[model samples]
Each structure stands twice: as structure tokens, then as C-alpha cells.
Target: MWLVSFLGKTITAAIAAAVPSCIGPLSENIVYPFKVSDNVRALVLTTSALAAIQADVQEKVENAELQGLVQNNQVKQWLDQVEMVRGELDDIKNRYEKRLRCLGDRSFNCWSNYWISKDAKKKSTEVQELRDRGKFEEVAIQITPQVQEFSVGSDVVPQEEADLQEILRYIDNDEYDIIGIWGMGGVGKTRLLRRIHNHCKRSSDFDVLFVTASRECSVEKLQEELCDEHGFGRGTGVVSQARIISNYLGNRNFLVLLDDLWDQIDLQRVGIPFPLGLVNQFKRKVVLTTRLVSVCGLMEVKKSLKVVGLDPEHAFRLFKEKVGNETIHSHPLISSLAIDVVKELNGLPLALITIGRSMYGKRDPREWEDAIDLLKRSRLNEIETTPEEEKIYYKLKFSFDSLESAELQNCFLACSLWPEDFPIYKIKLIECWMGLGLLCAFDAQNIYNPGYTLIGKLLSACLLEEEGSDFVKMHDVMRDMALWLVHTVGIQGINGLCKRGLELIKCYTREVVGFMQSGRHYLQAKN
Candidate 1:
């Protein structure tokens, strides 16, 4: 029976091997049954084989379903994470883009999506030739154009006359190596220095004459000037050039005008070398003009000058020169007013010159009075009417416009409310300012002790005139200008006061009506 069963099983296997389509049921029933010997064993083997096959098939199907679910979830999760990362990256890109834009308009290329290789080098000759002949040559050869160069004037001036005189005396005494002239703008400083330069040049006190140090003045320019003045070789390098010039000037007496000197300039830095210990080796006199007095002080000169305004007589002469002689007599009434006008000018040469130039050729008394009236009415605006007036207008405007803070401008305009030539007591001015609520937002320190600070800013800027120890005054013209600015700019300092007055009137009216109503109510109650 075992031999017969084995033979049957071998036949079933052969048939299944011949055709796989028949293997499932053949292996499940025929061959599988034959492999078992006893009835019970055969039955158990067949049932167990069928059951194992079904279980294997079911497990494979379940595994396939589970794998599909896992893959779907993984894709969804990965997509969500990718979206989050993408959002973060976008936000970072936007922030940097805004920052780059704020840097300048030239940064627009960063916004355009483009790729530039970090290690890119100039193309080889052959590759460049090919690129030049290619269709993309136009795009490849595109380049940004250079910006246009602009010319600007030097915004520097000379020192005052008193300062000039002091400098002159120092030169005469030969006490110092260099004399420096320094002061702020509109102080007639540059004019004074020029005058000194012209005077000294004519005197023949020095053998060689040269003026250098202009706007953007460089070592090369100085070297060139020095070389040209002494007829030396115009060498290329700064050190070589300067050394050549220094050697030539060593034994010669020279007057060098280093005009418009900036702060913290070292002669050695410009490549000009003199012997270490020789105090007056060349007697090379250098006159420097600068806005900073500290530069002059730093040079440790024997004499320093601080330029100030002219005296009354000099100011009068300066004014008359501007007005011209023909008009001086024809406009006697105007000329009579001229003395008062000069007084109002407060000895400023620029102011006098500007006012006189504005009144030039106009001999009409009415025109003079009108000009004066305009000056009284609106200081800056009146000056704007004529080209001559424009100069004084700009000078005053610099003082007025230099105020950076709006609160400061308000404080300045509030000053215009007072009568012309009125002497302002510091305490009283503070009280008025406080009453007007100007001090509400300011710090306690500024509110309580703004005397020196406020006056100093105004005085230095030439906005307010200092009257004695504790008083302040404004120029009549400046006062009118302030008033005009207040009205035009609609400054809240004066407007706020007017608004408060209106509010108080409204409140009083409301109180009176309420009182009348109460009286009526009392009469009704009594009846």
C-alpha cells in the first residue's frame, strides 16, 4: 500500500510540474492524500495542508493591504512636513529680500531668480570665442553701466578778523611752524583768511608762494602744487613726490597756504618729511582754514584767532559799499532808515551786505520802507523777495532749519509771539512755555533747566541773540521769520494756546446755561 501510495504521489507531482495551473488542487487533494499512509493520518495531513495553504494566502493578502496603508500615510506625512519646511523657507527668503531692498535699488537682481556659481572664473579664450559667436552672446555680454560723476562745491570758510590778526602777528613773530584758522559757517572766516593770504602775498615776506588744500584735497594734488611752485620733477608716488618737494623746500623760505584744513591731519601722513628736531628748518609757514577750532588748538600754535562780527563803523562802511553812492543820497530817508537797519543787522557783515544788495538801485523811500516792513512782518520771506535778500534769507534759514527736533522748532516759534526787541526773562519764558503745555512731554531736566541748552543751540545757530546774563532776544527779522513759520507750518505751540482759550469760553457758556436752568427749576419747585 505504501509503494502504491508513493507511486500515486510521484504521478501527481509529475502532472503538477508539467502544468502549474493544475498544481493547487492536485497538491491539495491527489498527491497530498497519497503521501499519507493510514486513513486517519491521510485525513489529518490533507486537512492540515489545505488549512496551511489558505492561511498563507490570507496572510499575504493582509500584508499587502497593511503595506498599502503604511505607504499612503507615509506620503501624506512627508507632504505635510515638506509643506511646513517650504513655508519656513519662503518666510526667510521674504525677510532677506526686504532687507536687501532697504540696502538700495541695485539689489533688485537678488529678487530675480538667477544662479551664479561660487567658483566661476573667466571663460577660457576658446570658450569665450564660442560664446561670442553663439545665439546667447547678447545676454552673456550684458553689463551694468557706470554711474555719472557729479561736481560739488566746498562748504568751508575762513576765520574771523581778530583771529586773522592774531595769526598774522604769530607769522610776524615766527613763533610757530603753522598757523591754523578755524570757525563755523557764515562767520566771515574764509573771507578773512583770503584777505590775510592776499595781504601776505603782496608783502613779499616769503620767497615762495603756494595755495593748496581745496575740497577733496589729496596728497597728490599738494605734491603737484609743491612741485610746480618750486619747478621740481612731478614724480608719481606720494612719498617720492613729497620727499622731493620737502628736500627742495628745506633750505628755502616758503609760505604755504593749506586752505580748508580738515581735522586730525598729520603732515607726515601726506609723505612730507622734515628733520626730527629742527624747529625752524625751512621756516615753512602753513596757514590752514577749518570750521573746527579744536584743529587749530591741536596744532599748538603760538597765536590763534577767533573771528567775530565787525564794529558799528566797519559794518556801516560795508553796508554803504553794498548800497552804492548814487542811491545813498537819492534815498536820504532810506539812508536815514539805513542806520536803524544797520542796528537791526547787529554788525553781521553778511547780513549788511545782503540787505544793501537787496536795496541796490532802488532809491524809492516807499520801497525801502516796504522792505523794512516786510522784514518786520516776515523776516525770512522778505529776504526771499530779491536775490540779495535771498543770501540773508539762506543765512537765517540755516540757523532756523538746523533744528532737528520738532519740539525745538516749536520752542523757537513760540519765541516769535513776544514783542520785537522784547527782553525775555529766562524764568518768565519758562513759565509761559510751561503754561502753554510745552513742557508736558519733555524731560524734567530739559523742562526745568533748558536755559543754557536752548540759548546755546539758538545762539550758535545764529537764531537767537544773547542779551545779558539771564535774558534772550531775537533779531527783528528773525522774529518775523519765526512768526511766519509758525503761521505757515501751523505749529501747535501757539495754536494750542488759542484752542485752550476757545475751550475755556465754551465751558463758561455751558456753566452759565446750567445755572439759569437751575434757577428756573427752583422757581417751579417754590410755586
Candidate 2:
């Protein structure tokens, strides 16, 4: 053994002396070339494992985004590094492939083989490190410091600011669990709820979920919306969905915002751990916005707030702002004309914004004068309504009439056929419009463009509200106006169709039976 070691040392010294600078490469050439194939194999295996983990992380990210959760910054950086490593691996593979071919029992370029093997071994180590790093316990996080800034401007009406503060105080009070915000349609109840949602996100430690309840609010529909937001699938029944929702929410502190609730939705039935006080030592609360004061009582709200319309001064300021300073300054009389318009609108937020937008660039005094005249006529024409309701509906009609085309008007009016606060599916509404011949198609294939275009026009006019990409909704007051236009004004096209359809389908009232009777009478007369 000593003789063999002495011979090995003598050979190594002779080689180092032959070329001192080549010693490093000569040793690596002997050591690494034999391991070249093994290193390449290990690299491929490590990369495959990494790819599998990357796919899992990507899927988790996509699911989290669907639930409105943001990914953690470290997770995002690791994903970026994974992509970069993939590019580097590709380069390494290409360089290895370009190496000189090996002949039987000998390499054509030993140095090339040695370098390629060395690079593969190093990259395999790095790839394995990345694989281990990718094993995260939590990949995504809830939106942090969740307060999103709303640009309501510095001129927020004092009443609204006060209302928001009062509501926040109620929210802080543990005794008030179910808080209700009730007001006339377009009086800013929904806006107040949104502000409260933002406030909860900022100040509170609870997980905040803001949802718009259906107009025909049902426990099942509410459950479905909540389930969708939480990435929960629709279960076998409401009971199952509720159980899943209850289990998930029961684990955390939660604040739920339910907007535009027209009727009472049972909190417990929708999967909320109600009376929230019993929630496993965690805090939970429900805040809702509704048009009906009775709904507040029906929901057993601890405290209910009435969101009143803006005062006259704030109303005029809001109108002028929406009308633009340029238009208001165009003629000295335009501002006064705007004040007249505001008076016609009755300090209602929706009417003010809609009418003001419609009058945005009208520099002509006659245009303002004409708008005022038509608004008065619209108000005078309506009957069987309270003063406040009458003002909003008729003032909204001016915007409806200002729709650039008759098709746009009909399309806007058609939305009112569904139940109040119901999200009318866009495709279904367009199909109905096409069936009614409201959309004149150049060809069968070309039909959808006109339908979507008309819907877009109505949306721009604020006559129709967007529920999501899939649905549009008509405000309750706007629907009432459409019905009024049909029954009282006798428009006789889509309007007539809406009234007849609503009576027959939505309401099993005397009007429906009367319509069938009238149809029989017409048939008898013809016979």
C-alpha cells in the first residue's frame, strides 16, 4: 500500500510540474468526464421535479386570484426565479449537445466533456435548492391594508361624511351586529355601505367580504354569491352550502357587506353565524343596504340608518361638477339653468349624476332651457306617485329620452321587465331584444354586435346598471318609470311588452288574469 501511494504521488507531481496552469483542468477532466452522463441525468430529474412543483404553485395562485386574494411577494419572486432557471437550463442543455462526439473508449474533446459535466453538476445543485425553496406552506395572502381609496373628491356632502362616521361608530360597537342602511332608491345607501367596507378593511382585523344581494334576495342566492367569493363549490343544497360557508367563516373574524338588499335575507340560513356574539371568541358582523325601511325591521337590525338625499347646496355643486366647469362657464346663464335642473332632480344622487352627464357638453342655452321644459313635462305626466318618487323617476326620464337612438331607448326600457334588483343576463336580454325585433340585424351572424352596442349605449347613459360582465340591472325607480311610460304614456312597443310580461310572469296579480280575459275578448270579437 505504501509503495502504491508513493507511485501515485510521484505521477501527480510529474504531471503538475509538466504544466502547472493545466493542473486544474487535468484533474477535473479525469474526475468529471466519468460522471458526465450521471450529472446530466440528475439535472433532468431535478428539473422535472421542479416543473411539477411550479405547476402546483401556479394552480394555487390562479385559484387564489379567483378568490380575490393576492399572492405573497416572496412567492412571486420565486416564480420569476424559476422561469430564469428554466432559461439557464436550456442554455446548458444546448451547450452540452454541441460538445464533440465521444468515440469508443476515448473522448474527442475531454476538456469540453469536463466543462459540460461540471456545469450540469452545479446547475443540478441549484435546481434542487429551488425545488426545496418552492415548498411553501402559504403561497398567497389576503389583500393587506385593504382600504382602497375612493375618489369622491374633497366636496363630499357633509351629511354623507357625517353618516359614514356614525355608521363606523355603530360598527365599532359590539352590541350592533346587523346594521341596516335604508333609504329611497338613489339616496346613496349603497355608497355608504361601500365606504364602510373600505373602513373595515383598514381599521378592523376581520376578513371583509362585500357582496351585492339580489333584488329578489333569497337565502340560496346569497349563499351562492358568498360561496363563489370564498372559492367554495355549489353544494347539494342550501343546507350544504351554508354548512361549508359556516365552517369557513366560523374560523376567522369576518365583516360582511350586503348591498342593495330589497328584502330580508335570513343571516343564519345564508351561512352567517348570526347573533355574531356566539362566534367562537372571534368577531363577526353584517351590514346591509336596502331600499325598504320595512326590510330593516324584518332583518332585525340592531341599528338602522336612513341615507337621505343631499341638501340643495351640495346638490348644485355635484351637478355642476358632473356637468364640467367648461360647460357651466360657457354661458353666464348655464349655471342658473343647472340649478333649475338640480331642483327638478330633487337632490337625488343618481338623478343628479345621470342628468348632469347627459348635459355634459351642451354649451347652448336653448339646450338647457329645452331640458328643463321636458323634465317638467315628464314630472307633470306621471301620476299615482309620492312627490320624492315622482321627482326621481321623471327626472331620470329626461336621460332616458336623451338616448341618441330609439333602439337605445327601447333597450333601456326592456331591462325594466325583470324583477327589481335582478341581474338580467346580458345574453338573455339581447336574445329577448332580438326576438322583439328591437335589434335590426344585417345578418344572423352580425346580430350580437348591435345588441351589445345598444347595451353599451344604455350603460353609458346610466339608464342601465352593470352587475358584472355577464349581467345588467335596472334600478327599481328606473323600472317603475319604464312601467309608467307603458301604462300611462302608451309607448306600445317594448314598453307594452315589458308590462304584459311582468304581469304574466312576475306577478300573479289581477292584471295578469285581466290580460288573459282581454285576449279572449279580442279573439271573440274577431270570430
TM-score of each: 0.39, 0.61
The Cα local distance difference test for each model comes to 0.50, 0.74
Sliding window of 10 residues with minimal summed lDDT for model 1: 113-122
TM-score of 1: 0.39
The lDDT leader among the candidates is 2
The sequence of per-residue lDDT tens digits that candidate 2 reaches over residues 76-195 is 999999998888888877876776354322234657767878888999988989999998888777643233433334566899999999998887888888888998888888777777
lDDT of 2 at 115: 82
TM-score, model 2 to reference: 0.61
lDDT of 1 by residue, 459-482 (tens): 655567666667777655566556
Model 2, 300: alpha-carbon shift in Å?
A: 2.0
Which portions of model 2 show Cα errors greater than 4 Å?
1-156, 278-280, 377-390, 417-432, 443-453, 465-473, 495-527
Candidate 1 colliding pairs, count: 7
lDDT of 2: 0.74
Most TM-score-accurate candidate: 2
